[model samples]
Target chain A: MIHPSAKIGKNVVLGQSVVIEENAEIGDDAEIGHHVIIKKDTKIGNRVKVGDLSVLGKTTSKNKKMARKPGAALTPLVIEDDVRIGCNTVLYRNLLLKQGAFVGDLSSIREKVTVGEDSIIGRNVIVETNTVIGSRVTVQTGCYVTADMIIEDDVFLGPCVSTSNDKYMGEGNYPYQGPIIKKGAKVGNNATLLPGITIGEKAIIGAGATVTKDVEAGKTAVGNPARVIK
Target chain B: MIHPSAKIGKNVVLGQSVVIEENAEIGDDAEIGHHVIIKKDTKIGNRVKVGDLSVLGKTTSKNKKMARKPGAALTPLVIEDDVRIGCNTVLYRNLLLKQGAFVGDLSSIREKVTVGEDSIIGRNVIVETNTVIGSRVTVQTGCYVTADMIIEDDVFLGPCVSTSNDKYMGEGNYPYQGPIIKKGAKVGNNATLLPGITIGEKAIIGAGATVTKDVEAGKTAVGNPARVIK
Candidate 1:
């Protein structure tokens, strides 16, 4: 059932028993699976295949400890053209999946996470809060990307890769810093990149490597306190 | 439409245009979302809420390198009674969500994971393969539990927390040992628990802490190479 305030483009195929909430927008030739929930202020682009049981744009207040006020401005989730969001994937508010980005099944993109154009997020990837993923990046299955990390363009994150963002973690308020991964870098499977470390462009982080320092461009690093191997 | 191969119990109230796939078993009074894909051999228990765009027992075999064989036997997903699975949550093959377990919206439980009874897994939590989460545990929002982790009962994992399973993290094969979090432990927000460590019972890991060694019971730990403060 499309709500009266919902905007539907021409030739949009909504499967039987679909529920579109108020102020949602579905573009032309979009196929919405059965029982999907497109909540308020969400925009679905043309020709997108939104699989069943997926919920988009469910708004909630940010963590009270991180916010200036109890209630803040609510932003909508925007999905650009030619994006194929797989089954059971959820995109919350303030998420923008640029054109041709493919989020595999069961992937979750948190708020303020911008997946650049043509990036591929594999299945079951948990992209934590405020991480910016660059265009044409490939994050394989089951990667845990912690908050405030920046993955630049053409980066390859292997399956089950891990990244951290805080160096001296404490309970009370602490200074916040962001980690940067430069373009064309490759982080191997199950690798652990520590907080505030930068991986230069085209650097290769070996599988299972624990990187604690910045790797120069085109170098290879590995180990517990990862040292440059090449 | 319940397939003939599907076994549904009495008093089940399926909403309009619900689709149950082959060999799926639904218990009494269960409410399945419309267009939800309860795939083959899934067992959903009584009074469960399988929300919209949510897919149960949908396993992807593309990651064949991680399996023992190229393609091993496909096991069923079992959900016990009173499980409240929210929108777009996905349980892959051989997952067992024990009685009274609550999986928040957009979470993903990968293959062979067991979520213990009455455990509350918050929004966007991703439990990777073979992780065993104990009863009454609470994994808060955006936490990533890596493979083969043993989280005991009454454990509290905060937002954006992560655990590693591999030490060297080499490719093609995962070679690192898993970590164990003992009962009544609390891992704080944005914390990182390295592999092969054991967090003792009643220990409190501070927010943004990076735990490296085995923590003693009732201690509070924090820092880059986390040390016990109390």
Candidate 2:
């Protein structure tokens, strides 16, 4: 069901059973796949492609058990020109995907997040709320980018990387702060970055490493407790 | 669309937009949620509860880049009595979920896998092809259980754990064999178990540990390369 208030531009192709809510806008040459759901106030720019079963501008659920409460006054979700979203992906309200960004299948991007231009979020990746990802970044499959994280331009995060925001695992009173991955840094597969650490520019973290502290710029860190090897 | 050959027993409740393919069998008192797809020849036992947007008996995809090729002669997926499947989960063909098993939201269980009775496969978890998980096992959220793995009864795996089956990461000709997690074992959060290792019964693996070798029964292992600490 396409709402009467929804705006669809010329030459746009919509598949079977697609739902466009009130005030949602789809630009020219955009293609929406089967069973895709676009919530109210979503803005999709020109030449955008959304795969089957994707949900855009979804609202976050708040429960009593949740440690972090989501913001109430979220704005409309914005997807700039040439953005591509794969099947079964979920993008929350107040999120912004810059031009030419690609989000692969089964991913979940939370609210207030900004993904810069030309970035790639691979399959099954989870980008939590309040994170900012810069341009030309590549986050591979099955990774967890915690809330309040900062990933600069040209950063490459390998598959299954785990980043933590809470040091006390919901037991302590400390503030939640995820890692800061600087520009051009590369994190290897299955690596774990503890809370509040900063990976300097062009630094390398080896596979299966458990990083406990800040890494120096242009250095390589390996093994548990991740000391600089170079 | 429910196929003419499909059999829905007494007291079955099917939600809107559901698709039940040819020869599918749904037993008595079964409750199927919205937008669910039950493929051909799939068998759902008595009192089973399936949540929204789930796909059962899905076929596997094979490509040239894939290291492991799926079996050709796959059979129908079978879900035993009282099994509960959460929202957006996908279960492949040739799979079996025994009585009372719970599969959480957004999880993917591949073909030829068997999950025994009363086990819990948590949210966003990935259980690759050909893995057998025994009864009462707890695999927490965001963990990756690689292909060809064996997990015994009462095992506990924490969130974001990673288990690998390929030692060479698709480069070498070595046979793929994931870790064997024995009965009552406990693996903590963000732990990485390397290929082919055996975690013995009642063993405890610490958080963020990189396990390179086998862990003995009744022991505790921690840190990178995971030495026995107890």
Model 1 segments beyond 4 Å from truth? A1-85, A90-102, A106-120, A123-198, A201-215, A218-230, B61-71, B173-176
What TM-score, to 2 decimals, does candidate 2 have?
Answer: 0.71
**Number of the predicted model whose lDDT against the real structure is largest:** 2
lDDT value, residue A103 of candidate 2: 86
Encode model 1's per-residue lDDT on B11-81: one tens digit a residue. 88775566777899999999887556787899999998877657788664332123334347768999999
Per-model C-alpha lDDT, please? 0.79, 0.88
Across residues A39-118, which tens digit of lDDT does each residue of candidate 1 receive?
A: 88899899777766667886654564763333366589999887877676677888898887878777778787899988
lDDT of predicted model 1:
0.79
**How much is the TM-score of the A chain of model 1?**
0.92
For each candidate, give its TM-score against the true structure.
Answer: 0.64, 0.71
Clashing pairs in 2: none
Q: What DockQ does every candidate get?
A: 0.12, 0.13
